[model samples]
Target: MDKSAAQNSAAFLYPPIDPFDQRMLEVGDGHTIYVEQCGNPAGIPVVVLHGGPGGGCSPAMRRYFDPAQYRVILFDQRGCGRSRPHANVDANTTWHLIRDIELIRTTLDIPRWIVFGGSWGATLALAYAQTHPDRAAYLVLRGVFMGTQTELDWFYGGGAGRFFPDLWARFVELIPEAERTDLVTAYHNRLFSGDMLAENRHARRWCNWENALASIETRSPGGESPSDYARAFARLENHYFANGCFFEQDGFLQSNAHTLADVPGTIVQGRYDMICPPKTAWDLSMVWPRGTLTLVPQAGHALSEPGISAELVRVTNTLRSEAVALGL
Candidate 1:
């Protein structure tokens, strides 16, 4: 395994968490969130927002932040993991997730901390920081996808499918050709037909396709499913579709950045990232006045891609160094 793909040794030099470190917080909206923290509590605080809108915590997530230099917090967003709901999408929404992050921050008494998230997580991190700009010290975002219509279109249309012809064929094989051309129709038909079998199949397909994306960028191929991947991914898709991703139009490119200019941000982008094009990162950089963009050419969407993970560690280190310099 490449050292870069592993969490930084300097980051984890401090005693790591116990084998079992999961905890749940109740936010009183029938909402309970699963959370775990590692690293130095006195060091700068850093929160890891897992992608998938549904992707939960991982042991690897702990490596991105220096345990000696950061209070690394990783958690399941609502029903995703360890949380009580178990992928239930009934009362979830984007704004709900935003408040959840803030609620966690307050519950932990963290006045301000760095937010690190990728893909959908990156979108939420930006949205949350934008809404509560004062609460965030900085942001480290990757594989930036800002819940835009074009992005959605790309996912259901030719964007991902064009790259993997065989996978596209398999995906389309799930639906009839007429409906295959209509992405929205296919999702709707499969997601809401009271067909548990079909929905589960759709969820499985979605999960498998995404897993393939992850595998492509992984240094070694291995993963353990908690048996909740489909339910969580489906729930996230269900959550987004319910709110239209809280976008009136192009989310990232629009007036949504009304508060982004007030925040300092750093973006680590994989130049070859196909899942969420690095263009989204470029678009974000132009709006965030105090933003810096680093392009990692040898990367895909996976978290463990070549030097991407090492760079993530570096980002966390830089943030702590900067914050301490600021007397944080």
Candidate 2:
């Protein structure tokens, strides 16, 4: 079905619900992330990971699961959303976030749970599941991003620019000619330039570039993100991209796909996902013995897209029946 027709069809997401528990979790390094729990308190556990490394969880995120069956957990990564010291990137790394996830699990007394994430969140879910394979019962990922340099080059470099030259030109025009060669580094310098005004300006452009290409339906550039959100999202994203997502080696997830040999996973990818194209998802499915990849036509990177949301809800609903068999 076309994007509009799919959107007009029945809503795929479950009904919205408030969190049964919420708190500020201190996970060291002077950072405390916001954690919230929704759905059945005694239901099977499922942790939701938001994208952007800095993208905080939202109310819509809580609606993907069946409230009567899955105990949903969502949290704002360090330096974003309701987390303390807003926009601060100190001591934040891929490994640190993994540690925080474990801390949340242990604190809540969850033995094992489903790991659901998309975009950068997919990157974290893979890292976390690989690090603590035993703790991950099953994996549901969308808009797969492996945090590899090639993937980074595709979006920040001229790869995605090839398709959206108009938006790309606007994004590139912000930096001088010499700095254009390394857009990520150039943006990093400005985003952390200590001038809040300059930072916000560059941050909006940085976020606008990504947001413009987030969905298949977004043809024109959207309005500027709020200064606070744009600052956090751009800074944290740039920080990670500049540092190669804090990985010891390139293609870390692919090399370590063996760790997930026993863990089954489902990857829902948009066929036209410009921010995180489907190639990475295909590569991951190839390496992951039990992984399944579902390519959704007329879809892009945004989790809210009709086709993407429908597939995700279908996957989550299917998993609900198998929860008992999986020992959830």
Q: Score every model by TM-score.
A: 0.88, 0.97
- After superposition, the stretches of candidate 2 with alpha carbons farther than 4 Å from their true spots are 1-10
Indicate the residue-level lDDT of 141 in model 2: 98
In model 1, which range of ten residues has the least summed lDDT? 215-224
Candidate 1's error at 198, in angstroms?
2.9
Best by lDDT: 2
Specify the poorest-scoring 10-residue window by lDDT in model 2. 1-10
Error of 1 at 6 (Å): 7.6
Q: Give the Å shift of residue 92 in candidate 1.
A: 0.9
